[model samples]
Target: MQDIIGRIGMRKAALGVLALAGATILAALAYEHIGGYVPCELCYRQRWAYYIGIPAALVAALFVRSRPALAAGALAVVGMAFLLNTGLGIHHAGVEWGWWPGPAGCSGGVQVSTDTGALIESLRNGQTVRCDEPAFRFLGLSFAGWNAVISLGLAVLAGLGLQRFARRHLAAV
Candidate 1:
C-alpha cells in the first residue's frame, strides 16, 4: 500500500487533498442550505481555510507535472491554511467549552445600545449569532471539533508530501 501510494506521486496526493477540501466545503454548504443549519460567525470564519486551500491545491496539482518546486511551495501554502484552521478550531472548541469568551460581536449575552434609536435599530436587525454554542453536535463532536480533526489530518498529509519531496530533491542533488 505504501509503495503504491509512493508511486502515485505528489500530484495525485495534491489532487486528493484538494478533493477532500472541496468535499468538506460542499458538505458544509449542504448542511447550511439543505439541512437548515445556519452558520454562526465562527462557522463562517472556519471555512476560510477551505476557500484558500482548494484553489491552492489545484494550482499545486497543475504545477506538479512540470515544476516540482512550485508544486512543493503550493503544498506549503495548503499546509499553512490547514494549520491556521487547526488553530481556529481549537479556539472555537475552547469557546464552546467555556474556557474563555468569544468575540464581543458574536458571542456572549445580549447587548443594549446606549442610544434609544440605536437600541431599536439593533432589535430590528435581529439577534447576532453566538460563537460559543454549536448548532448541533454529532458523535459527541461539534462541527468545529470535526474540522479540527480533518484539518489536522490534511496538514499531516501535506507535511508528508513535503518530506517526500525534500527527500527526493536531496537524493538527486
Candidate 2:
C-alpha cells in the first residue's frame, strides 16, 4: 500500500486536495443555487479563502512532495480557510444578536439618506447582503454558522493527516 501510494506521487495528493476543495465549493453552490440561499458580504469573503486554499493546495501538492510542505500547506490552507470562516461566524452572530453594525453597504441596518430613488435602486439590486438574515439552514444554524463548525473539523483533520501520512511521505520521497 505504501509503495503504491508512493508511486502515485504528489499527483494523488493534488487530486485529494482538489477533491476536498471541489466538495466544499459544490456544497456552497448547492446551498446558494439549489437551496436558495443568498450569501452576505462576509460570506463571500469567507469563500475567497476557499478560492485561495484550493489553488495553494494544488501548488503545494506539485512541490517535490516534501512532507513538511505538503502537511504544512494542507494545515495552512484549512487553517486560513477556517480563520476567515471564524470571523464570518462571529460577525454573523453579532449581526443576529445585534452586537455591532454589519457592513455599511449591506446589512439593511445601515443608514443612508441619499435619495428615495437611490435607496429604491439599491434595494432593487440587493446591493448589500445582510448578516442578520438567515438565508438557509441545515440543522438549526445558518450556513455561516455551520461553516464555522465544519471548517474547524476539517482543519483538525488536515493537521492529523499531516502528522500521520506526512512523516511516511517525507521518508519515502
Candidate 3:
C-alpha cells in the first residue's frame, strides 16, 4: 500500500481526488433526488468543500506536468478544504447524535405562533428539515458520519499527492 501510494504521481493523485470528490457529490444529489432524502441546512453546507475541491483538483491534475508547483499549491488548498469539511461533518454528526447543539435555525424544535395567519402560512411552507435528525443511515453511521470519514480520506490523499509532487518536481528547482 505504501509503495503504491508513493508511486502515484501528482497528476494521478489530483485525478484521484477529482474522481472521488465528484462521485461523492453525485451520490449526495442522487440521495436527495431519488432516495427522497431532504437535506437540512447543515447538509447543504457540508457540500461546499466538495464543490470547491473538485475543480481545484481538476486544475491541479491538468497543470501537474507543466506547472508542478502551482499544481501542488492547488492540491494543498484542496486538502485544507477537505480538512475543514471533515470538521463540519463531525460537528453535524455530533448534532445528530445529541452530543452537541446545532444552529438554532435548523435544529429540531417547533416554534409556537399564536397568530392563526402565521401558523397557516408556516403550514403552507412545508416541513422544516432538522439538522439534528439523520435522513438516512446505513449500519451504524449516518450520512454525516460517512462524510467525515470520506472527507478525511480525501484530505490525506491530497496531502500525499502534494508531498509526492513536491519531492519529485520541486526538489529539482
Candidate 4:
C-alpha cells in the first residue's frame, strides 16, 4: 500500500480520482442530454456530491503537495459524495415504493390555486419532477439503483487509494 502511494504520490492520485469523478458526471450528463433521460430530485441530490468531490480532488491535487494528506481530503469529498448518492438512491427507491415524500420543490409543489386556467398553465408548463419515475435504467436497474451500486464501489476505491497513501507515508508499511 505504502509503496503504491509513494510511487503515485498525491498529485497523480488526486488527478486520477478527479478524472474518474468527472467521468461519472459526464456519464450522467449524457444520460440526460443525449439519452433523453430526465433527473429526479434524488438524482440532482446525488449530483451535489459529485460537485463537491470534483473540486475537493482538484484543489487538493493542485495546492496540497503531501500525498497522504491530500488523498485524505480527496477521499473525504468523494466518499461523502458516494454516501450521499447511496442515500439518494435508497430514498428514490423508497419513493417509488411509496415509502415517503420527495422534496416539493423538485417533485411538485402543492396546488394552491384551483382556477382552471392556472391548472392548465401549470400542466402546459410541464413542471413536474415525478419522483416515482425512473428516468433511465442500466441492466434493469434505474439510475438511482445503479447509483447505489456504483457509488459504493467508487467509495471503496477512494478509501483504498487513501489507505495506500497513509500506510506508505505515515505507517512505514
Candidate-wise lDDT, in order: 0.85, 0.65, 0.90, 0.71
lDDT of 1 by residue, 42-113 (tens): 889999999888888888889986999999999989989999999999899888878888887887765667
Error of 3 at 67 (Å): 1.6
Stretches of candidate 3 off by over 4 Å are: 169-173
User: Candidate 1: where are CA atoms >4 Å away?
Assistant: 1-8
Order of all candidates by lDDT, from best down to worst?
3, 1, 4, 2
Candidate 3, residue 144: Cα displacement in angstroms equals 0.4
Best model per lDDT: 3
Tens digits of per-residue lDDT for model 4 on 1-173?
A: 66664465455656776887788889999988998777766788888877887888777677655454655776667767777777777888776656787777655556556898998888898766677766656677777777777677656656665665676667764
Writing each residue's lDDT as its tens digit, candidate 2 over 66-128 gives: 555654665567556756666777677667666777776567867785899988886787656
List the candidates' TM-scores in order: 0.90, 0.68, 0.91, 0.74
Q: How many clashes (backbone N, Cα, C below 3 Å) per candidate? A: 0, 0, 0, 1
* Greater-TM-score candidate between 1 and 4: 1
**Residue 70 accuracy (lDDT) in model 2:** 57
